[model samples]
Target: MDEERNGTGTHLSDAQLFALAAPAAGEPEALPAHLSLCRDCARALREWKAAVGAVGEADAGELARRSPEEWRAREDETLEAIRKAGSHRHSIPAWRWALAAAASLVVAVLVLTARRTAPPVAAVAAHATPAVAASSDMSAADAADDRLLRDASYLAGGGDVDSGSGLESRL
Candidate 1:
């Protein structure tokens, strides 16, 4: 960056001056290149940086010391503000949309992969029901459950399991 404005000591164009002096002031990029190397521009940049810092410090000083919960709330509020800012803002880079899209695709793939690779459910029920169905005239759905409980109770009580209950015999 040439420091001198053409070495003519003439004032620079307004865009050139702004780009050098107040870069954070949203100056567009088509400014004069010489202004970048100017000592005056360097000084102006430092001044603006200092001014912005002081203002930030003053704003921070206005707040009181907060409790832990208040600190958490403030943290949440700051994060929420940042979230709202990232979501709806137009002044920043346009590439953010591409980044967000990429992240969403990654998340979608991860969810799909997890679903695809997840463990299969046990097949204990399928084999048992059909085999029991062919062997017994009893509706295996109801009778098998009754048989299981009766067998478990008989085993637990150290007694012989009866072949047929009075209800089944009557049926």
Candidate 2:
């Protein structure tokens, strides 16, 4: 039925037919051009209109006959059911808490174990000092080379070499 209505598939949608059949304000809706061209859509629209009419015709005398006290009791019962549903609590099971605690304990033990097995920070820093000293010594050598180049340039330009301290003495 759905395939016949929409999948094969050039007919009007069920919603469009329903809207034409049951206009909300009880006014007749304008028919689409497709409805005049398509027999299936016309039949579907008639079916929808009949269904809507049947629903509208259903007797409401039972509800109309209900006393005010009966309606109040029904309302009270509905409210009590809603209150009971809202008040019910959902609790975490005990095994879930136990599992969570176990996982936390495992993580804590792993962290403590790793800390105990690793080298201390003071010892690591002590081992790193010799490498740092070596780098500083290399920089000092580079500074000495730069000073020699500057002095050689000054001498080549006929500047007084005797004005500054002797190169050997500075070295």
Candidate 3:
């Protein structure tokens, strides 16, 4: 690829043609010596320059066709937008901070009150059903599996199988 690009015999690549067509701002690129000798590359560069010029001219023509009123409205809208952007508040309002602090305090108070009012774990466990009490002696995995199976069975409308209650009684 390097040889193909640098070879004086070969035509300029599309990228090289574009660079020649639109040189970088404040930085002029030296034209390849081959471009002067190669009519095909020179013509391609001219075509690229024409295309780039057409793109810029198209937008200018569109703007030129706009009515004076439309131009003024567009200018006003742009200025208003710039003004609003510049005037944007960077700091939060005092009321917002106060409200947030109050909200946090309320939530903390509610959490603490709930904790105080709730029954202790031992008391709750004491009131649990025989199955729940029995699970206390089982391994964690076994207990989790047991709970899942119980939930599934309950959801399926099948009451506890070990409760001595027949399906007829449940129905």
Backbone clashes, each candidate = 2, 0, 0
In model 3, pairs of residues that clash are: none
Number of the top lDDT candidate: 2
What candidate 3 gets wrong by more than 4 Å, as runs, is 1-8, 64-171
- The whole-model lDDT of each prediction reads 0.63, 0.78, 0.76
Best by TM-score: 3
Say what the RMSD of model 1 is.
Answer: 19.0
Give the range of the ten consecutive residues with the poorest summed lDDT in model 2: 1-10
- Tens-place lDDT per residue, model 1, 1-171, is 344445536545444544555566575445455446666665555565576667766778636445688889989999999999977676455677788889999999999998788654455467567756755776767676666666666657766446443334433
Ranking of candidates on lDDT, top first? 2, 3, 1
**Which tens-of-lDDT digit does each residue in 94-170 have in candidate 3?**
66789999999999999999999999888887767667667888898887677666666675895665665343343
Cα lDDT for residue 15, candidate 3: 80
* Model 3 C-alpha lDDT versus the unseen true structure: 0.76
TM-score of 2: 0.31
